[model samples]
Structure formats: structure tokens, C-alpha cells
Target: MTALRALLLTVAVTASLSACNRRDREPAADAPLPAAEAPAEITPADAAAPMNFATTSPYAAVKLTLPNALKAQTDLHARLYADEVRLLRQFVEGAQADRSEAGDDPSIPPYEKTITLTAAAETGKLVSLRRDMSEYSGGAHPNTTARGVLWDKALKQVIGSGQLFRRGADMSLLDQALCAAVNTARARRVPGAPPLTLAGGGEWTCPRAAATPFVLAPGTVDGKAGGLTFLIDPYKVGPYAEGSYAVTVPLTTFRTLLAGAYADEFAGQPAN
Candidate 1:
């Protein structure tokens, strides 16, 4: 009987020990699971997402969007955001003042401003962007503008279009080509409209290449830039009614004028 009791006690102790071991090895029902590991690098879709902001009030309404590609560029993105903030503050103040003076004038519509920045092309260490802005402040019609930006990923800075050309290089050839292209585009938009003159009086005068904002256009060949697409805002080369114009100057037109550093970046033709 004593031996049997000892055996039973031994079995109970072993079962308890085993139960404890099992409890130690298993997770608690309420415990949180392990967190997922983040990706080592940003994916293309993540880089292409846009950062957007908007607000509306009785005095004004404002909207702004910045592409993730631009936002990924830390320094440039900071500068652009600072500039936008300043502009936004000014607009809000102006709108408030106008409202105060108007004293509930129903005819005065709420002032508005919308700005969007989008990636136009990316080649090598350069990313091209386009900015379109529209604003209205008690005007018959809203005013719209478009501009281009070239960001150097290596340098982490904005570069002017002139940098693509050799120092002291005569840009007259480029200007002539751009003018011809603009006139050709203008003719198609407004049938029988007088052709734009390179150096003529009035709003119909063709804007010089130096005066236009241009982005590196995507090319047919991968990893190579096709050409430059000039962004012309309203009232620059034509009446406001004609709206904006985008004219692409092929690489072949200005390939000879390219700086040694940028020559290799150009090839094929514009994708669109």
C-alpha cells in the first residue's frame, strides 16, 4: 500500500511539471503578436503617392498637393513647403481683409487657391516635375499658371534648365526651335490664328526658351530622356481663352548644345 501511494504521488508530480512546461512554452491568449518588419527600401508605389492638404472657410479655400517623389527629396520638399506656407498665410490675410471691408457682400465669392505638383519624368539622377496653380480673388475668371522643376537626386537640389547647356553656348538655336514648335502647336489649337512671332509686339509674341519652364520629358528608350517639354501659362504666349500649352522640343533639336555631363542623358524621342 505505501509503495502504491508513492507511485501515484510521483505520477501526479510529473503531470504537474509537464503542465507548467507547456504553459511556459505557449503564448497567453491576450498577449499581442509580434510586429511585422518594415521593408528595407521604399517601393515604387510608396514613392509615387501624393501628399495632399485642403481647407475651406468663409473667407477662403485652399488646396495643395505634393508628389511623394518630391517629398522624398528632403531639402527641396522643405523649401517648397515653406514657400507654400508663406503664400497661404498671405492669401488668408488678404482674404480676411477683403471680407472685412466688403461687409458681407454676397457678390464677392470666397477666394480660392489650388496648387498641385506631379512627377513628369524620372531619368538617371534627375526627376522632372510640373506645378499647376489656380487662384481667384474677386476676378471675372480664375488665373491659372504652370511651371516645371528639375530636381537632381545626387545633389539634392533644384537645377535650372540652363545647366543642361554648355557655358556661354548660344541658345538662339534652341529658342528658334522652341518658337517654331510653339507656333505649330498654337496653329492647331486656334485655326487661322496668326502664327507667333519670335520677337514681335503684343501677347501673340512667342516666349523665348529662357523665359519658359521646361521639364525633361520621358523617352521611348528606358533610362534616357527624350527631350524638354515647355510649360507655357495662360496670357504668356496667347490670350487667356487659349489656355495653357505644352510643347516638346525633341533631343535631336538641341543635342549638339548639350553639356558633356547631360549629353548622355538624352536619347530616342518623346514618349508622348
Candidate 2:
């Protein structure tokens, strides 16, 4: 099966925007010391101007079957995929099944349900349809906090705008092979694996030993803006494996951001 990529891979940071307002016609400062001006009358929703979602450039989507495996070979591999999914389901199902005898459950177990998208990826879109989404760990994100605010705004921009929202994942930690596609993906390695040699006269080096010694083939993507660093050795985690995942942008968000991003904040104003 094709590895599910570009699925629910989202990362975020704090951002904001500023709007200009017109000055109210008033008399001299001395004359203004009279009755305090009443607070600007608040506008009701029905009376407020409509917001244009089209200008926004974010598309909401959920990554299905991520942080989960599909198949396994050995018992060890089984633990990596199927077994893990089962145990996770057990936790989500909770003690309801334990109080009843087999085939007598008033409520059926959840593991058998077909919903597969993680809560993080499915956020801000059609939610009631994916009833089983409650079980996703990432889905139960807390609101009323700073991260929650950013998530909501960012997600709104993404879904409402229908723009391409690319999630960056650091796979250099998972599979060194991906380094072939994104040179920035370099991770530690195991012995007897490929070594990260300084290739093409680049100053890059393998952080750890490879399965075998090899050159650190540093390269660039054609007409792309980011650097690609390759990792050679395969690192192992006890009874499992791990790697880095990152999101990469492709001009769209960056261009959209130029209007309000870190560098664009000073735009539409005087040269100070």
C-alpha cells in the first residue's frame, strides 16, 4: 500500500494582524476634557458587515491513519501496528465492555467503527458527520487558551479559503530514505547503516554512524526554497521506531502571508 503522506501533518505558531481606524472629528484638547465620550457602540452580528472567506488561503483536512501502522510482519511488527491500534481502542472504549458479558453489551464497542481520521486533521470542518472523532487523542484539544485561539483562526483561514494548506512533518527521524526527496531530513543512524559523508563539498555530516559509511549527499530542490539534508543510518526504538516529521510550504501560504506575515507587518504604512 502507498504510505499515506501529506495527511494531517500540521504545525503552528502565534500570528496576528492590525487594522487602521479613522479619527473622530473633535474640538481642541482643552474642550475635549468635557463629558467622557461614550464607548463606541458595539455592533450586533446581524448588523456587522459580512466577512469574505475566499481571500483566506487555508484548506482544512484531516490526516487519516497517521501515528498508526497498517500491516505487520513479525510479532514485533504486530506490536508496532495492529496491537497498538487495539490497545488504543481499548482505552477509548473504556470500562463499559468490562461490566457486561460477551454478546450482551447494550452499547457496542468502538474499535470496529470505520472513522479513521485524527481529530487534529479533521478539525474546523464537517465535524458531526465524523461521530467517532471523539476517540482521536489529537481531536480533544483544549479551547479557551492561546494555542486554541491560534488553532481556531488558522484553521478557519485554511478551511474557509479552500487554499492549499501543506503540513510539514520531519520524517528525517523516521526513514532516512525520505532524505533523498528532502535534503533537510537528517537523523541519527545505527551501525552498519549508511553514513552521512560530506558530499559535494557541503559541510554536512552524519550525526551518527550508518549501516555502512557513505557520503553526506547534500543537495537542493530545483526551483524550491528549502535545503535538503540526507541521513544515512537507521535508528531504532525499543519494540518500535521513530523519526522526525515537518511541514514544507510551497509559495502559496508564503505569498498569502506577505500581506500579514512577520515581514509584511510594516506594509501599507509610512516608511519609518
| lDDT leader | 1
In model 1, where do residues sit more than 4 Å from their true spots?
1-50, 201-203
lDDT of 1 by residue, 72-124 (tens): 67655654554454455556666777666657477666777676878898888
Tell me how candidate 1 scores on lDDT: 0.67
Each model's Cα RMSD: 25.3, 24.7
Every model's TM-score: 0.77, 0.20
Against the reference, the lDDT scores of all candidates come to: 0.67, 0.21
Residue lDDT tens for model 2, 3-120: 1011111111111100011011110110001112222222343123221111111111111132221111122122122322433333333322322223433453222112232121
